[model samples]
Target: MTAWETERVAWAYLSRVTQGPSRVVSDFVERYGVVEAVRAIKSGVVPRVVAERVSARAHIDTAAADLDAVAALGGRLVIPTDDEWPAWRLVGFQTGEFGGRADTSVPLALWVIGGRSLLDVTERAVAVVGTRAATAYGEHVAGEISGDMAVDGWTVVSGGAFGIDGVAHRAAMGVGGVTVAVLACGVDRAYPAGHARLLQQITSSGLVVSEYALGTTPAKHRFLARNRLVAAFGEGVVVVEAGWRSGARNTASWARSLGRPVVAVPGPVTSASSAGCHRMIRESEARLVSNARDVVEEIGSALSGDDEQDHLFSRGDDRITGPAILVLDALPGSGSLGPHEISELSGVPMSDVRAALVMLEMESLVVRDDTGWARAQRRR
Candidate 1:
């Protein structure tokens, strides 16, 4: 093997031996570099924390074989040393770690497939995610938002599972827009199996990426680990329909931890599936987003993080539209109502209600809190 190939093999070894979010090992690799770190780990000379994480698998070296396996499938191992390593997108994992999120450790390497360049597509990506046991409303909403985002030149990203993730991927493809799937399993094996064809379609068009080795199968813990990547890659996350304790909620937390804007779609209050999204909105961290336009607005503000406040509230100066006025009047003076309640009270659909809320919030006519939406100090 060439020297570069040898370096990649070392990365493969380190990446395969342990489950990630191993901040100690990540730091060791940072301090000593991949080549030397791999040597020390193998020779049992690494730190106690690193050894505890890797000792079980350290003796088994499948780096060469795994590299060959991915290559045989027409994919490649993308290491940090490579130019297309997604450094810009994944950079937040560093700060994410310091911010006390255990799941935010930078990956040692990745296995990627498909024709599209990973870096190019992730530049403006949004993760559309929710429950596997999704409702028709959830699927419908996911499709509309994903398709619209695609048409607007944003890459739609998801976990490649059933329900919302699958809907998001297919919707993006239906519009011939870029989409990416960050898998918990090996890129070679479709974990849901039903989406084997969907995974293949993604390979033919966008990318299917994983940090695991070529044969890694999906598992409970791995899926949790995978959510961080979905959040990290996307500039924002939009939860369509999530149960109270679903992976979509986990992804939302990761997004919030990464300082990415998180948007939640409120559903019918009676929907058990939408419990998580509603709760997230109630927590006041996630923006209420009902459609693609709302998602773009939230993500646009996030991207322009350094720009003037005027940039985000550019439309704030405009006279409040009819919808905004109606939404304003729907609010109970002292208490709060959620988007759905406001929709019902104002005789407006939740999508329009969300837009009006955005305008109202910017204009200081309304505010949102853990309880939901209420009147602000003054109406603009």
Candidate 2:
């Protein structure tokens, strides 16, 4: 095998033996090289901690079998050196602060099963995650935002579980857009079992990725560890609905730590499912997102090179047209007006006025308050 192939095999073996972060193994690989580390492990000359975890002979055999299985499934082992790897997404984890756990190292390799390249699908990705016991409203919002994001050329990334994650993936796929499902377990094995078909669809058009070896099962701690990968893989993360202690909140924490934008969709205050989202917004940990447009705007701002003032208020005059411009013109300079008021003032139909309001809001030319909508104050 070539050097890359040799490294792939060694990483796969290391993945099987290491339970959690593999910081020690990563350090060993960095110090002595993958080939040398593998040799030392096989010779029982490695650290006591690693030696106790794996019997050299059995572990090596398992690793070989894992590789064979992956090959049989038509999957590829992607290391950092691979051309198709999403290196940019993994950059923040370079310092080993993955999941905000200093002991845990970033994944050394990923088992990717998909037709499209990882980078191709994840170049402009957003993560939509929430509670498994999502309400009807939460699911609806997740679907709408995910579908819209997909249609706008942004891939939706999520854990392959029930509730928000499943809805997000299906919504993205329904629109014939690429979506990635990051798994806590091995990509070959479906953790929920129910999402097997959905995962297959994702792989056919996008990607199913995991850091684990072929047969690793999903454990409670594994899912927590996996959230970091989900957070890191996307440009921003959207939590549709999460209760207190929800795993989605954990993902949000990881996103914040990585300096990636975190957006929370507000739900009814009475609902427990939305408590985490409300807390995030209240604590100023995440920006509030009401629709796909809001999500796009928040993430775009983070990615844009424009100055804050310019990005917030500077839109070309020609960009606003038709009913949108009419509605903007109708708004009072110092006070808010409802959509109905704007419709009457602009001589535009109520339906057109509503549509215009959405467009205007996205452009930051208008602001909505409890009373109504008003023209946004332009930066001097």
Candidate 3:
């Protein structure tokens, strides 16, 4: 084998044997080159902390098997020196402390499965993350924003979990846009199992990536560690919905620490799922984003020197007009209400309410079902 391939295999082996925070592995690789570091670990001359956790002498065979398994799966191992690695931006996060984990470090290697390069796929990526138990409103907003971003040639990045993540991926794919799924488990192993099909679709058009070796299962700590990768990979992160203690909050924190812009979509006041997003906005940690336009503006400003006015939210004249606006606003986000109920709530005359509802229905701003009327799913 070539010298580069030999070193790549050794780095992959080290990734399998190392445990107890990524900083230990990162520091070792930094202090000694990949080949020399592997030799030191095998010779039992490494630091006491790492040595205690990594019994390299015992797991050498398994590590070799892990490399073989990845190869069998057609997975690519990308190290720091690889041309396809996104080192320019990821290097910044690796050198900084995040989530109070001083031991946190950049991944030793990334296992990717896809046809596109990691650097190219994430060149203009934006992460849309949120709760696994998402509300309908949250899902709608996530899908709309993700779809718009994809149509504009920006890749959507997210954890391959259910709820918002699934919606975002589907939306981007629906528009024939690229997306990247950063996984806590091996790229070959789908954690939610239900998203197996979704992950397959992503790999066909984009990429599925992880830091763990093949066969590694998803764990609580691994997910937490994986959050940093999601945050660091995107130029900015948008939290669609998150509870008080959601994993999405961890990603937002990492984005802030990495000097990346954080945006939060506001949810109804009564939703517990939106508590974390509201808190972030109130604390000035994240800007409020109501639609795709808001997201594009925020991300564009952060990414380029273009004038803000040049990228303003451009909703065409198709926006709801006249009494239709009042009637549409009167509708509840959840259940439907009749015209009389909407008239009473909106203070519009009954005659005007009926006329506005007709106009709104034709424009798809509202829908009339067997129960009554409700706001239609409008994508902006």
For residues 253-362, write the lDDT of model 2, one tens digit per residue: 88876667899999999999999999999999899999999999998777653543222222234344445655776677699998888887665679978888888888
Q: Using TM-score, give the best candidate's number.
A: 1
Ranking by TM-score: 1, 3, 2
Clashing pairs in 1: none
Each prediction's Cα lDDT score?
0.83, 0.80, 0.79
lDDT of 1 by residue, 67-170 (tens): 88888888998987575666656655654433555656877788999877787788678999999999999999999999999999989999999999999999
Instruction: Locate the minimum summed-lDDT window of 10 residues in model 3.
Output: 308-317
Q: What is the overall TM-score of model 3 with all chains considered together?
A: 0.77
Q: What is the lDDT of residue 367 in candidate 1?
A: 84
Q: What's the distance in Å from true for residue 204, model 2?
A: 0.7
Off by over 4 Å in 3: 19-21, 56-58, 97-99, 304-380
Point out the higher-scoring one by TM-score: 1 or 2.
Answer: 1
